[model samples]
Target: MSVTAQCPRPESRALRENHPVMGADWGPFNVIDTAKQDWARGWAALKKFTEREAHARVPYEHKEGAYPLGQWVAEQRRAYGAGQLAGLRARRLEKLGMVWSLADERFQKNLEAAKAYYDQHWTLCAPRTETALDKPVRQWLSNLRRPGALDDHPEWKTAPEAVDKDWNPSWPADWQRHYAALRERVRDEDGPADVLPGFTVHGMDSCRS
Candidate 1:
């Protein structure tokens, strides 16, 4: 599973400072959060094919309030490869794409659920400290950032690191050194309890929820 295409540009806080759009982007999103409002717009676009106004629709709602990630992933692969779909010539393709979009919505739901679950469990196991931390905990956070890491674990790929590097200052050299040293210390203290847990195990367990 490979993720191609560039991530969308992040909206500036200055542009969003006092005014934010209001509507259900998706989820339990409050109309107040600028980012969430943006997401809601995206969610609405994906949902267009399913709306009653559309010429076609698919019964793609997931039961758990989240779309099936594996299903969404499969459809996406089809869309990207020799199986690209569009218009009347590709009615099946367009329909599947709509379902895929619903699957995406479901994925978002799962994301929120997983984040909440981890946040709750995280607060339980240990206090937030600069020193020692749980390997599982780190993996959980990492999985949230990159869902595909669970199966592929693509370390070679680099994603957009800074939200706006030109506008925002990069981490200081000393800060990087401190961070690396902090991780090393935490790993050493963690002993052999899988000092570095990958997304595989934790991610699988999370989806079960």
Candidate 2:
């Protein structure tokens, strides 16, 4: 006769079965997985924004369907700058035309406003209260002209200079505006320009010498 030998289950397995610690009520939670899902959701929102705007330079206060996409973008930039962003994620954002530096983005926007002002007036000597492209052009120029304002980004000066060589003239901006008006009048008129005291053109007094 052949006898069959039965092996007893491990004590730990019996304990686990009795305690039911690994039942459906207790499931594993992965924080990394949750964070990845959140990141993917933000990326989707950003992708949609880029599809519509053709760029990922989201404003600081922008939102996409209740998601703070701009804040997410800013956080990504910070992580990238700190070398904490994953390489794949950075590449994906770069592919979408992400503007990493807010300062550079702001400068480009202001430069566009300056260009528009020059196009309209043929000069960049706008008054302090002047606005162009919904931006405070004169105030932006004043800020750029402050001492050491562009110390870290000296190359920014060349952009405005390219738009107008005398953008940052040694003479007063008001004087430049008057000179521009006078030149325009001379060009438009057929005879020698007659300049008398108290004469005004383009709302500027020609008598103020």
lDDT of 1: 0.37
Q: Report lDDT (CA) for all predictions.
A: 0.37, 0.83
Where does candidate 2 clash, by residue pair? none
Per-residue C-alpha lDDT of model 2 across residues 22-102, encoded as one tens digit per residue: 432323431248799999999999999999999888987999989999899999999989989968998898898988887
lDDT by residue for model 1 (153-177), tens: 3332222122111111144423333
lDDT of 1 at 63: 20
- What is every candidate's alpha-carbon RMSD to the true fold? 26.0, 6.3
Residue 138, candidate 2: alpha-carbon lDDT: 94
Model 1 is weakest, by summed lDDT over 10 consecutive residues, at 160-169
